[model samples]
Target: MNTHRTAHRLVSRAATAAALATALGLGAVHTATASAPSAAPLSVRPAAPGPDGGWHQNGLHLTAAENKKVNGFVARARRAERAISPGVRAAARISHAELVGFDQRLKSPDSLKRKVATWMLESPGQTVDASLRKINDAVRFTLQWPAGTYSQGVRTAAGLLSAWGNDSTRWANTWNRPTGYKAINSAWRAPRSGQLFEVQFHTPESKAAQLETHKLYEEQRLPGTPPERVRELQEQQDAIFAAVPVPPGAERLTAPARRLPSPDPARRLPAPAPAPVG
Candidate 1:
């Protein structure tokens, strides 16, 4: 995910530059509504130097062990991406009104009763796929969200960063790393329209405390599991990705992704937007 954030930083800068250039009339006028440039295509670039003076050529300069960690992480994230994409698309189709209302709730930051909905819906295939990409950037790659969920997501994302940054080998250790979240569950309400919601934590202490009662989920929870289950749970774990169909571009992850077996769909995939009190 750091890769996504770092990469998106590049995209955002490009978008801003494009906008600024157009605004200054230094180039042909472009509409503000014009689409921002897509983030760089997924490629294995070299790692840059580490602050500690260790090797890091872009993302490729990691030590052999670190490289394995990274590769393992990317493969897992990719598989998760593929598995979850369809679920996001499916949920979107089945719960359009709920998502619309949920989207509206996002505008109100301090609603005591109306917490911002975690589940977002988008059309399947391209729209959903693109949105997933953005979420990966927003959640996994970027450090954009509040800390608990953010850090937990980031540690998991570190593996992906290793991958996109060209250090796919880091994954095994990355996959084996402890996930901080206690549980992932959903809730539904029809206050105005059908809406689904979820909450994730950022604090390591909280996640660790929460993890005690939910240890069964640990193995399949992050990059440690197989691709098939990743797809299956993608819908339940993250409704946004669950609703979309996995794109052809997603194949690299699904096919050669993690070597683990698929977790059971029933256990891995929860119902739409329910709360996880644990």
Candidate 2:
């Protein structure tokens, strides 16, 4: 569900140089905005990265303290990923049984690391602990339905969300993304571990459209891109999503309600069954 950070490091340096040039009155430059995660409720809204965010945006070259912070968060998140992975896979299997063509995947460790590093660079005000908690895609699943079954996909999503929440808590939901974005994204707090993970719903066509526009998103994140070009790219993305038909009642899906009485903090899932030897 992610990409472009490593690739953009050099571009960022060039932008820095351009900033220096502008200070000398050689030319003017436009600063870029914050971007979202891979396999996430990845948004392209403009945000000023907080000062003192402990990141030197020279492509995520963190100070020793900041590096330790990222490593600590990754270690904790990996354990959480292991704890919920079995249930997540089981849920995916049940989803396929309920309706065909749904695809599920977890974000790769490298991708997670990149997301964390870049997020810190974009938000210097938060400590790594707080930043990681806010990142919901460390473990994520994508459910892709065919074009005509958007409504059915949303229904399947409701069932999956209900089951997944038995041992997890729903902490975030964004069904009403701006018109330019075309997907449903949510996060849940895993029981006992208290780590957050992401869930996304997409139609086959919409998924393809997202992949098609990913590069544009990267370029739009560059500080040197003229403001007009940024606006143009957003319009292009909107047009692509506009062509995707919204199934009746798809927008009405709600974030699952918090569990009644809440899940016990000390509760733990039983050990997952061993995989069958093939």
Candidate 3:
């Protein structure tokens, strides 16, 4: 469980989910006339696909029992999200919010099982209990504000959330280092169920870039994509993100300082050297 590697993969998936939702026009629908392009529907029923061509189902497929348990957990998490929405909305308003998007969805059984399988390959011996414990984003959301006001918006939201209930700052993560896209990713324990859910804060431009890069990200996930082709997809995404201008004050928004728990020694993997940035 090389914590760093695990964190990187989890955050990458979170970013990808956000980008996909935006691309699908599932985010804030401001105008009734606005329309998004249609694509093939995601399979609601879980059936493991074979590893051929560009598709792979090497990841874990959830058992019927596991799926039932996860579904129950997700339902409780959504209730928690609904309970907290008022406070979040009020806080954003006070922070001079420009636009906000609130969403809560259970990762389809197919998606969750795929991720679990990937985790198993990355860190063998992790049981279903361990995997479920790490599933923190069953209920997720994104918030956006004007470019220059991002810092204030984040601070206000954090403060309000802290005052509202238990804020898991130690478990919170941020991904602002990425070019074009900047986001503060945090988690909180729902008061009643103590289930963890994620919140993402971004600026309008960054959100738009995320939407633009969603297709590329999806393509890169194809099981049989050549390594070189994957690299090309990433470079294309980077180019689009590079063009998104970061407004003044946006760079100063920092994730709270907290020490993350160490990775389970039993599941630890050898840490790889950092990749060089061009």
Highest TM-score against the true fold, candidate: 3
Model 3 lDDT on a 0 to 1 scale: 0.53
Of the two candidates 1 and 3, the one with more favorable lDDT, higher being better, is 3
Per-prediction tally of clashes: 57, 4, 2
Best by lDDT: 3
lDDT string, candidate 3, 1-278, tens digits: 59546544443333343334434433323311222211112333334333431223543355555555545554565455444444444444444554343422334555665565556556768765677778777655566777666666676555444444435643333344565345566777655557677667777777788888988987777555789999999898889888776766655565533334435331132211111223
Q: Count backbone overlaps in model 1.
A: 57
Each model's lDDT comes to 0.27, 0.51, 0.53
Q: Better model by TM-score, 1 or 3?
A: 3
Between which residue pairs do clashes occur in model 2?
A: 1-38, 1-39, 32-223, 53-124
Q: How far does residue 20 in candidate 1 sit from its true spot (Å)?
A: 46
Candidate 1 wrong stretches, greater than 4 Å: 1-62, 97-278
Which residue runs of candidate 2 sit more than 4 Å off their true CA positions?
1-59, 97-124, 164-178, 261-278
**Candidate 2 residue 55 C-alpha distance from true site, Å:** 8.8
Model 1 RMSD, rounded to 1 decimal: 22.8
List model 2 lDDT by residue over 63-180, tens digit each: 5565556556655765565555444444433334122111223444334445666666677775666766667776665655555665554544444444334333453323345567
